[model samples]
Target: MKRIVVLLAFALTSCSYFEKQVPNEQELLQKELKAINWNQVDEYPSIAECEKLTDATQRKQCFFEFLSSTIQQKLDTDTLSVLYPELDTIEVKITVNPDATLVFEPQFPQDSTAYDKKKIDSILRVRLTDLPKINPAIKRGIPVKTQFILPVIIRGE
Candidate 1:
């Protein structure tokens, strides 16, 4: 009986020696969050056509190309080129929201007095509203908001 009691006590005490410390939920979450890179996304925002692409770089290129082409087409229908004859290109800041909404803001140069900023902004807002459905970027399997600047060329012809 004494040997059995001693063995049981030793086993119980030794069990703790081999056991590892389990982190709490908050600590685990913090550690996981820290491991993630906030600036880079696992997947780029894409349209239905770009979804078929498997390569990350190709997919990103496809998305940007599609967006730029679509924006170019939309702006072509407007008189932005005619209104601002000297403005051959405009840098547009595109925001892809997690909810799949897109916002476009035209970035003008410091000497932007040659162009009507309000009218150009209104034209961009109106023209860009007809974009096709876009999937938000993915970070660790979860959709995330992303913003990038795209330079769109304007053809005066």
Candidate 2:
């Protein structure tokens, strides 16, 4: 009975030696965060037409090309080029919000005094308001906002 009691006690104590310590919630979360790459997204933003593409590079290219063409077409209908004949190309900063809203801001050169910036901005706002539905970019399966600068050519004709 004494030997059995000693063996049982030794067995119970030895079990702890093989047991591994589990990391706490905070530690686990920190580890996961470190593993993620914040600079690059898993998927770029897309429209319904570009969504049919399976390749990442192809989809991104399609989205940018479509956006540039759409912006050019919309602005062509307006008097932007006629008002600012000196400006042949304008670099517009496009922001794609996580909620799928778009914001367009025209970037002008430091010495650009020939054009009225406020008037140009207002025209852009009106022309760009009725764009097709956009799907926001995805990072780690979560929707994220993205911004890119697109140079749009102004048709002088």
Best by lDDT: 2
Over 53-126, each residue of candidate 1 has an lDDT whose tens digit, in order, gives: 88989999999999999999999988988988888899999999999999999998788687888999999999
| Best-performing candidate as measured by TM-score | 1
Give stretches of model 2 more than 4 Å off: 1-11
TM-score of every candidate? 0.87, 0.87
Q: Could you tell me the C-alpha RMSD of candidate 2 in Å?
A: 2.6
Per-residue lDDT tens digits for candidate 2, residues 32-78, read 99999988889999999999999999999999999999999998988
In Å, residue 86's CA in model 2 sits off its true spot by 1.5
State the C-alpha lDDT per candidate.
0.92, 0.93
Q: What is the lDDT for 150 in model 1? A: 99
Compared with the true structure, model 2 gives a TM-score of 0.87
